[model samples]
Target: MQILEIFGIAVALSIDAMVVALCWGAVQPTIKASHILKFSLVFAAFQALMPTLGWFAGGALYSLISAWDHWVAFLLLFFVAVSMIREAFEKGDDNEECECRSMGSDIAWGKLSMLAVATSLDALAVGFSFAMVKTPIAMPAIVIGVVCAILTALSMLAARVLSEKAARHSKKLSLLGAAVLLLIGLRILFEHGVFA
Candidate 1:
């Protein structure tokens, strides 16, 4: 894939991480630099690693599923996007304290690892696609990981900066997140000939 295309795909895959980080930023008293770095590292590392793993696994199964690869991609992305949109719409109390360590659990490393893996599931599937398409997974995976790291950190920063004025606009942010997801879902469907 071309660089721009890879970047686009990376962005699409990173949206979930970005949104979660935004939520984390909003709930925290003050977003710390360390928090951003932690999220970026966990997210980026997982994003990078999952695709290579998927590529290897997918390499084995690619022959059996070559024709359905695009469809699988479309389904995975579409579902992920839709779920994000749905989560964004759910009303919730924002009174919970935000710790840089864990979302709702103790065990910092374990929680962080789980969060990273949870957020990077899409990349796992994309890795599978790389195998199916014979795309060089290393470059694209690196690109995805780096971009997600930057974007997640930036999003946390942005949400922290905006939290003061953004208190009233939380729902709007969620809606915007949802819209981005829907658009990505549509793009995937269109790309896969779901509309044709």
Candidate 2:
């Protein structure tokens, strides 16, 4: 529940949002500040909301599983890290293929919402982990939301700023992000004294 720990978790949880926003940035004919703002807001909202929802759900089950809360937290993070790594290696769709290049992608509310939901699923699990560990959800949720928003915006800007470089390194970045998550998960286990 330390601030640094929460921040680490937030960063780990935001990787998906960042990648998605990066794709959006690349596909648009021209990137704008407003577009970045919109993507960040939508992605951040879902990332924040999912955790709060998970926290509530986890709260209901806390007393029933208090003894193994740390284990659950560690497991949740490990699973999320694994999932991210898996996705990074998965086959790319045409949209995914052109992630760091300009392509005509229609931006709509439904698509944005779906993307938001898809990217925030890990945050939902993270929220559950927070609840299990008795971590206060408010501060952590805020950190996650803010970090996700910033990362999403940055990814978009970075994509546009260095489209060619991004195109070449996007997968490597994703892999690095997943590795960070894996480390964060291990850190959580260590911090909880679960592996000591």
Candidate 3:
């Protein structure tokens, strides 16, 4: 895959992390630099790691599925896209109020780890898709991690100013990410001559 395409995938995969970071930023009574660093590092690490794991798993299965790898990749991306769209429409969590009330200034390592893993699940699938399409995982993984870290950090830092607006329009942002993944999936199909 081209660099631009990899970058697109990276951005698409970072949406969940970005949204969660924004929420945390908005709700926390005080956010230290340490918190931001810790959150960004954890998110980035998971986002990068999951895809690498997926790539390895996909590699193991590649020979058996080689004949129809393109289809598998497209389907995986489609599933992820659909899931994101579904999540976008789900009602806001009632627990958010409680979270905001309870969240203090310090970082919670356990919760951060869980959030990181949760957000990176989509990236794992993307890595599998990359393996199906025979794309190199190194650049994509690095780009994905870096982009996620930057976006997460920015979202957290900007929450003070944009939190309310971001919260209101988060669904739109999610839909946009899903659209990007859908388009990327279609492009993969086209490249494989599936659309020819």
Q: Is candidate 1 or candidate 3 better by TM-score?
A: 3
- The order of the candidates by TM-score, greatest first, is 3, 2, 1
Error of 3 at 169 (Å): 1.1
18 in model 3: Cα distance from truth in Å?
Answer: 1.2
Q: Where in model 1 is the C-alpha error above 4 Å?
A: 67-107, 163-196
Worst 10 residues of 2 by lDDT: 94-103
Each model's backbone clash number = 0, 0, 0
Q: Where is model 1 poorest over a 10-residue stretch in terms of lDDT?
A: 98-107
Candidate 2 at residue 181, lDDT? 63
Number of clashing residue pairs, candidate 3: 0
Please list the residue runs of candidate 2 whose C-alpha ends up more than 4 Å from where it truly belongs after superposition.
91-96, 99-106, 191-193
User: For all the candidates, what are their Cα RMSDs to the real structure?
Assistant: 4.4, 3.0, 2.3
lDDT of 3 by residue, 1-196 (tens): 8888888888888888887777778877777898789988999999999999999999999999999999999999999999889988883742322134344566579878987998899988989998999988998899999999999999889877777677677778888889988998999899889878
Which tens-of-lDDT digit does each residue in 14-59 have in candidate 2? 8777766766676677787878888899988998899999999999
Better of 2 and 3 by lDDT: 3
TM-scores of all predicted structures: 0.69, 0.85, 0.93
Error of 3 at 31 (Å): 2.0
* Candidate topping lDDT: 3
Per-residue C-alpha lDDT of model 1 across residues 62-168, encoded as one tens digit per residue: 77887886665556555655665665556344433334344632226677788889888867766876675577888998898999999989888898665444444
